[model samples]
Target: MKAEFFTDAKPLTVSKENFGLERGPLAHVLVNAMLVSDTAKGGSLQYQVGYQLVYKPDSPGKKLPALITTPDMSSFCRLFLERGKHYLLGGMLDQNGGARVDLCSLAIPWKNVTGKQHRELLSYRCD
Candidate 1:
């Protein structure tokens, strides 16, 4: 059997002008996520995550479902991400219109997240 390794990838840059609508909220957000499932196949990994918008720079919280993908096999162990744990995640919509979280993204255990980090994430400005 081949051992899998984790890899880090840069996040996609999101501009205020094109994230969504001029009047809509920015696409970047901080979320509290519960890992529902994780599957690996064909050189890709997919996570079925249920998340609540913990903080958005300009909007109220909301609950939603997302499918996060990563081409790196090591991302699972690298982030210590696992099923049934609540995690603090920094996420954005990918080009395919699905929410994504990866090595370069901010993903940590909820208990490990600091208040300052939360505040900073909540106050981020897309502009």
Candidate 2:
């Protein structure tokens, strides 16, 4: 599968613009993980991919969810993460406390994460 499915895709920057404006505290999670599974949910066509946390630099020894939902974006753009591949994922915690990521969020392959990009992602405040 082509990792560059999202043309002009860039690493996420450290800015409030990357997060939602929803009221209440936002718990952002950024981790280096391996894509464990990818499956389309029923008829909705949305994918609920699972990832094994390989590294969580911000919150060491903290427990975090392994699965993150990917909204169905077939109409526009979609992120297709290959199982067994490592990725640097960053996303906000939804109201349900579940982690959700999409084409708009940081979902870059581990090999593609540059030193600068890694530092920038680490700079973000992760709860």
lDDT of every predicted structure (CA atoms): 0.46, 0.45
lDDT of 2 by residue, 12-108 (tens): 4445653531111112323334343334532112233344433333335544455555644455445566655667665544444445555766676
Distance from true position, residue 61, model 2, in Å? 3.7
Which RMSD values do the candidates have, in order?
10.1, 10.3
For model 1, what is the C-alpha lDDT against the true structure?
0.46
TM-score of each: 0.48, 0.48
Which residue ranges in model 1 land beyond 4 Å of their true spot? Answer: 1-42, 57-65, 75-80, 115-127
lDDT of 1 by residue, 1-127 (tens): 1111111222445577535312112222233343433344345445665544444433344433355655445745323366666666654454444554456555667767688966775786556
